[model samples]
Target: MTKNKAVFIDRDGVINEVLTKRVKFVNKPNDLFYLDKVPEAIGLLSSADYLIFVVTNQGGVGLGYMTEEQLEKIHKKMKIDLESEGGEIQDIASCIHKPNEGCSCRKPEAGMILKLAEQYKIDIDKSYMIGDRDVDIEAGRKAGCSTIFIGKEDNTVDANFSFPTLYAAANWLKSTSNL
Candidate 1:
């Protein structure tokens, strides 16, 4: 089987709006808010034959701020919304451990990506990871994938490219693919 190329996306701040009020995390489907251009951006990448996946850290779950059931509800809603707009998510993975838990699947670690690669037979070198934080970039780098950092967030390390939004990154990928 040919190895598949994927576009791994960070959940919060990239797909949904980042929540800052609770200090916990997005604990419900009601808290999930899709960005304006997210569906289009994801669709554009999907059209280019990239399998889209989501890799997120939900420390809130481990901290008792959110339940795994709640997280699943939010993901189900997100997938429905994205699919409605002609986008598809092949898989979703979350690291539901706090920083003190020493989990290997969290951002800045390669556990999640490595698991996905093993499960899907993905080509890590050809895949790309897009997110809005330094941890995301670090994870991508550790996973041997190209990285795109979204938003004007302070990512003073390890990102292959930085753009203002996912749309911009998608445009860059689209343009580069034609070359």
Candidate 2:
């Protein structure tokens, strides 16, 4: 059976604004503002028939910064907003483990993406992972998916592609996937 192509996205910096690298959690639903052109980019991806999945490391739930219920609410709001803009995300998978805990679902680990790939029968090679951090790139590579780093030159993690923003990367993904 043929598998579907997909795009795995990071939550903090790719989908929503990253207030600061030091503090990486949307504690309140009110804090979940997105970067410019995010919804438009997502809509483009969706229209191009790429299954979109949000893979995030929301350690705040385990660290007591926020509750699981609060995270759910935040995600609910995100989905509603995205749909309002004509974008649809197939699923959302988050790792609630702390950074110190050697959890497989966290960034830098491909567990979440791998599991979702299996469940959704996704073609890892045909899929793209879009993220802003080094760990995000690492995870995508480890999962055998193309990685797009949404930042300037970063030596720690080498990505298959690098763009300054998710919108730019999404445009590239759309054009490249057609080839």
Candidate 3:
């Protein structure tokens, strides 16, 4: 059987704006404002025929700032919006455990990605993980996928590629023949 190639993306900072001032996390559906060209970026990747999975760490749930139902509602709205804009997500996996919980599914850990890959028969070597933080890259590296960092030049994390925005990364992925 042929394995699928996927892009596992981080939620906050990468898909939506992280409002550090307004709230540390997107506790409500209304608080989930997307970044520029996010829909377009996802659409581009979708058009390229790569499966998309959102792997997020919603620590706010464990911190008592939000409930799982609220997180579901927020994700529902996100999916509706992205679908309306021509992008499709295969699934979303989130680790609601706090940072100190040391959960296997959280970022900086490969559990989430590994589980998704197994469930979907994804080719980790051919897949990619995109995020704005170092932990995301670390997780991707651990999972044996190519990592893409979407942020300012950070010398700390060793990502396969770096871009300033999701759109830029999508463009590169679309143009790349290796995928």
Candidate 4:
């Protein structure tokens, strides 16, 4: 089978506003909010024939801060909202294990990416990972995918590109891909 191409995205700071220092999980569906220009950004990427997948580390679930059912509700609502804006998510893979647990599915480990690649038959060489943190870039690099760091500060990772926001990353992808 032909390998698929994908864009792996991080959830918290990349998709929604980051509530730093807050111990809250987006436990409820109503708590989900897209960052400014996020909808349009996602719309642009969706139009480019890229399979959009979210690879997030939600350790709060394992820490007992939130329930799995609650997370499901939030994700369902998120998918609905994004689809309403002409954005589509092919799948969402999450690492619910805590950092101390030494699980392989977390960011910087490339476990989730590897699993997704196997499941979707994805071509890692043609894949891109976009997020707002160094861990995101590290994971992408470990998985042999191009990395795009979306943040004002330099991530210091050998990322393929950097953008101030998801919208900027989307624009870059659109122009670079000529889509």
Candidate 5:
């Protein structure tokens, strides 16, 4: 069977706003605030036949800021909200370990992406990882996928491309011949 192509997206700061000062993590459903046009971006990517997966690092669970059940509830709400907006999420892979836990599934590590690629029969070479941090870009590179940084142009992170938002990235991907 032919392998599928995918787009791995980071949850916080990419799909949802990360209130750095007010709230460190989205521990509850009410804390979850989506970034502008995120669902539309996901829908656009889906239209391009790119399976979308949210790969997030939710260390707050390990830190006791929230429980696994609460995380589930938040994800459920997120899924419903996106689906209602014509966007689709194939799955969500999260690393619940603490920052120094040294887990393999966290951002900057290829474990999550690799496992998902295997599970979904995905072709990493044709896949892309869109995120807002250096770790996310590093993870995608380690996983053998193109990386798209969703933030201001920063030389610190070596992303293949940088965009202001997911929607902008989606548009570029749709028009790019490289993909």
Candidate 6:
């Protein structure tokens, strides 16, 4: 059986405009905003036979800033919006544990990607992980996948590629990869 290649994307900061800085995390469903050309990018990867998964670390739920139900609402909206634009997300894996909880599924820990790799029969070596944070890149490295970092901040991430936005990265992947 051949393993599928995947593109694991970080939800906040990468796909959605997150409330960062002093107050991080979306407090309400309306707080979630889509970044530019997210659906278009997803579509490109999908057309290239890449399974797209949203891998996020939402510690706000565990920190009492938001409830699981609230987060679900936000995710539902995102899915609906993206799907309406002809994009599909294969799955979503989130680690809602607090920063001090010692969870393995958080960014910088490859547990979530590792589990998804087994469940989806994915080849991590052929996979790509795109995120806007250093921790996200670290997780991809730990998961044995090449990474693309999206953001204007200093290049603190150890990614194979760096782009200003997800769309740019997706375009590059489609053009460069045989997949």
lDDT of 2: 0.88
State every prediction's TM-score relative to the real structure.
0.93, 0.94, 0.95, 0.93, 0.95, 0.92
Which residue window of length 10 is worst by lDDT in model 3?
17-26
TM-score of 6: 0.92
Between candidates 1 and 5, the TM-score winner: 5
Residues 1-179 of candidate 1: C-alpha lDDT, one tens digit per residue: 89998889999989878756632357888887777698888888887778889999989898898889999999998888887767789999999998778888998898998899889999998899998888998899999999998887564755888888888888788777655
Per-residue CA lDDT of model 6 for 12-131, tens digit only, reads 888887675533567677887778998898888887778989999989889998889988888888877776656688888989899879989998899999999999999998999899
Q: Which candidate is the best by lDDT?
A: 3
In candidate 3, stretches whose alpha carbon ends up further than 4 angstroms from where it belongs are 20-24, 177-179
lDDT of 6 at 98: 95
Per-residue error for 146 in candidate 3, Å, reads 0.3
Candidate 6 stretches greater than 4 Å from native:
20-24
**Which lDDT values do the candidates have, in the order given?**
0.86, 0.88, 0.91, 0.85, 0.90, 0.87
Instruction: Flag regions of model 5 displaced more than 4 Å.
Output: 20-24, 177-179
Per-residue lDDT of model 4, residues 1-179, tens digit only: 89988899999888876575442447677667777788788788888767889999988899997889988988888777777768889999999987779888899889999899999999999889998888889999999999998888674656889888988898888777753
Please report, as a residue range, the 10-residue window in candidate 1 with the lowest summed lDDT: 17-26
Q: What is the number of residue pairs that collide in model 6?
A: 0
Residue 171 lDDT (model 1): 79
Clashing pairs in 6: none
